[model samples]
Target: MTGWARSPLKSAAAWALPYWTRGEPGRETPSDLFRVLYLGWAVALTLKVLGSSWDVSWHFKWLRDDLAPPHLINTVGTVIVVALTIVHGYTGYGVDRTALRLIQVGTGVFLVAVPLDLINHRVNGLDITSWSPSHMLLYIGTALMIGGVIRGWFVGAPEGRTRTVMLGALFLFCLENTWFPSQHQEYGVFGIHAWDRGEPYAEPILLQFAADQMGRSVDRNMVVAFSLPAPDYLYPVYATAVCMLVLVLARLMIGRAWSATLIAAGYVAYRVLIWPLLMVADFPISAVPFFLLGAAVCVDLAFYIKVPVLRAVVGAALVTAGSYLSLNLQHTLLDSPPLANTSAIAAGGLLLAVWLGGEWFVQRYRLRGQPTGARVSATATP
Candidate 1:
């Protein structure tokens, strides 16, 4: 198992070292296989989006009207895209790390699975249930991508307190939209409400209304649709304030450790709160918390966790749980809708309080002035 795992790392080093050391900066962008894979996946998603939009019955009627040979084009296109993504991720890029490679591969697999599941849903009329394979795949893919970006690509180290703080902040920012009600009511981005009210191609017509209106008389349909009362915007404002406060607390407590924690906390909070709201509300916005969070967490964990095995386990578990919670929280919360998951919520609050309190304690003790290994390392590393 170890040998098999290490193979990708050794191969990546052999492939990347020469290019990284010798490649000219402006001559051409360095060809990281993962980047190529990312592009390929993006292209696939674009195609899927196009196909889905064109074939409205697949979405609205939930019937595979374009079920003839032409469907093969979509299927084949999807399969090829998924295959490329998996291959790209499996082959570690620009770094020789077995664990990271595995994560990449897993992420690729999940990415591939999302489209496949959607395709299946279209073809077979699968009951769109929460926690379905497709849904799980989407969540997993999101978490992996966010973790990777934050920990692997940006922060360079995940375990450090700085990385954690930064990650938390980022999460909060991305998920901030969740606390707010869907903007679809205000902007006819998706389409006019009539279009949503069984009106065919309401979105295109709404767009036309915007173009025609050009700040002229507002379309009555658009106005009425968007005019529905929603929760006070102040709630999100307050949430944002609280989120920022948390980041500030982390910064004061962790110092250089602030960045990573902020990013992580922000990412987690967004995924936990915002993304699901948008998706559940069926707003026009794309839910991308997973992508951001996955990239962030992967990079963060890489730097933070010293023990490889423990890092892998904890990172994987958190990614999975976070993704699940983020993706399905609306359904879970709305369906059963716990008024009091008090213990869990309380635990989280306690942890935050302790973390903040410790920061205060350390400051009071003048730990900043005291010569400690972290301080010495911080000073010496730069």
Candidate 2:
């Protein structure tokens, strides 16, 4: 046998026993095992992200098919996730008990959600909105699953470039999912504009179905309702309240100087890369949230504040102001909607509250007089 083949065989044979033995819970995993296991998770999640990106665009152009190519791509990722769950469950190698339970429950919830989603579609015929209850369940399950993986990787993987890179990548996926629902409006604006200009982006069947749901004919009004169902205020508020929150958490979790900026940049870059590809494929494209980079920069800067409470307060304000400006800039330059004054104020106040609450939780959770950085580092690889 070749030395290359022999080496892997030897490692696998050696790995088998401890894997089956289910060694002590929360036990320290070997660095090599940790790398391989978490890297698999990273790849699996990347596949899921790509599939979801395509799935959203696909829905805009075609009716929901049970066996669509995007669904098949997602299914492949789910299969890998299931296999990894089994390995983690049996081996206790890469995860502690709590992490294992999270993975198991998340996987179970996701599995259950799949059938429910199909049933939802069967009953409601062509429910394409990603904000539907069934779809939310899927997103929730995915969040839980990603949370478990994050916990596992954060605790298990030794501190290094590998750990930093993996954690950052995971945050990017999380941010994307967090911002996903907003795409409805982002795409809708463009779709409506295109329809007005003599070229409609949606297929006739899709427009017909949506119109039928509202007892209306396929016209401009129907198109407006079908495409831009959400209120304009929601987009910016969500950007601050939900998506920016994720970036804040990423900054905390990744524990790097520019982690938030890098992650946000990565997300925007991915969107730009796919935008042309989707256009070439004749699928609908949405407005990319370039403003996230501004907020992300603020998130990173927020950490430099020495006092936690003041930091959260000032940081929230900064993110809100910076992002609002960026949103306006994007609206002027891109096909995005104008930012509302009410949304900016509401977003700032809400973000401040959440940021303060998060700070209190961090302070209370730590041992007496323990430095905040120490507490943060305990959950993250520095």
Candidate 3:
């Protein structure tokens, strides 16, 4: 007889007890279970990233459909994430209490956002902008969920090739999530360019709706408004202050000399690879963030400075300069969005402030004789 047929409660307790015991907070999990759990996490996150990427491109090409293929793919990823979250909660394998709590909270938020987002769509005509509040909640939840997974894997996995590879992959996903919202401007650049060439990519209906919302006729002016909705400053600000900060964190967490560069390169490469694929699938494409790699390199170099405050200042300066130069080059070569110098300076200042604040917090944390970062755990033998 199956374990359940013998006695439901007893069998359940028996099965759960070992997992609970084996996976107590800060305790190493069995090798097999560790691999299994984190591998599942990797797969689920990959699906979500892929789905979300396709979904954005899909939106640019067609009208919103609840049962669109991209949405279906994203739903499948969500289902897998829900299953993984349940397993993590029940067994506590591969995650500490803090990590588990983050995962739970994030998943809860994402689930709640789903129905709310649908309601938003029903009411708001077309939630075309990725910067909408409801959509941001989804991104926030995903960031939280991914952040938890990054912590769990960082702390629980023993130092080895496996850990390095897994952490790098996770950071790449994190970078992707961090940079996702900027894709609107990325897509918009090419979108307007295409329209100027008398070959707009968005469907006529989508263009009409977008124009209608702004009380304008469906013309070049409407397309310009629809395509480049956000101000130019927002893009560079996000690129310098927000996204590059993620690279800095990845460098610190991975504790690798080139971790930030590799992760940024991987993200850029993924975008490039997907560019042609999306076009072949008859979807809209966006300008890839080639400048990210240059900024990432500067971030890695800054980490070598040893002194926290000085490191932050120098790093922010380097990244700001490099990113501005790179953005200008891209604009010249590929007709990408030009980086405003004023915006770059503002973003750099913001980055420096945040970095200094982080250093202060870490110093305080150190003074308190508490662990500053994730706790390293030993791996248990099977």
Best candidate per TM-score, number? 2
lDDT of 2 by residue, 262-361 (tens): 9999999999999999999999988888888888899989989968889888999999998998888888887685467678889999899877776665
What count of clashes does model 3 give?
A: 0
lDDT of each: 0.38, 0.80, 0.80
What is the per-residue lDDT of model 1 for residues 1-382, given as tens digits with 9 covering 90 to 100? Answer: 6998899999877875554333211122233543443445445544543343223222221222335333554455467555643443343332223224434654576658756876876754532222346745654554444333322222122245443444443334323322222222222222333345554333444434443444445455544333322223322222222332333333332334335344555444533454355446453322222323432343344336544345444443443333334424532433211112223333334334444454455456443211232211112211
So what's the TM-score on candidate 1?
Answer: 0.32
Report RMSD for candidate 3.
5.0
Give the TM-score of each candidate.
0.32, 0.89, 0.89
Backbone clashes under 3 angstroms, per model:
65, 0, 0
Q: Give the root-mean-square deviation of each candidate in angstroms.
A: 15.7, 3.9, 5.0
- Model 2: lowest-lDDT 10 consecutive positions: 367-376
Worst 10 residues of 1 by lDDT: 373-382
Global lDDT for candidate 1? 0.38
Ranking by TM-score: 2, 3, 1
- Candidate 3 accuracy as lDDT: 0.80
List runs of model 3 lying over 4 Å from the truth: 1-28, 360-382
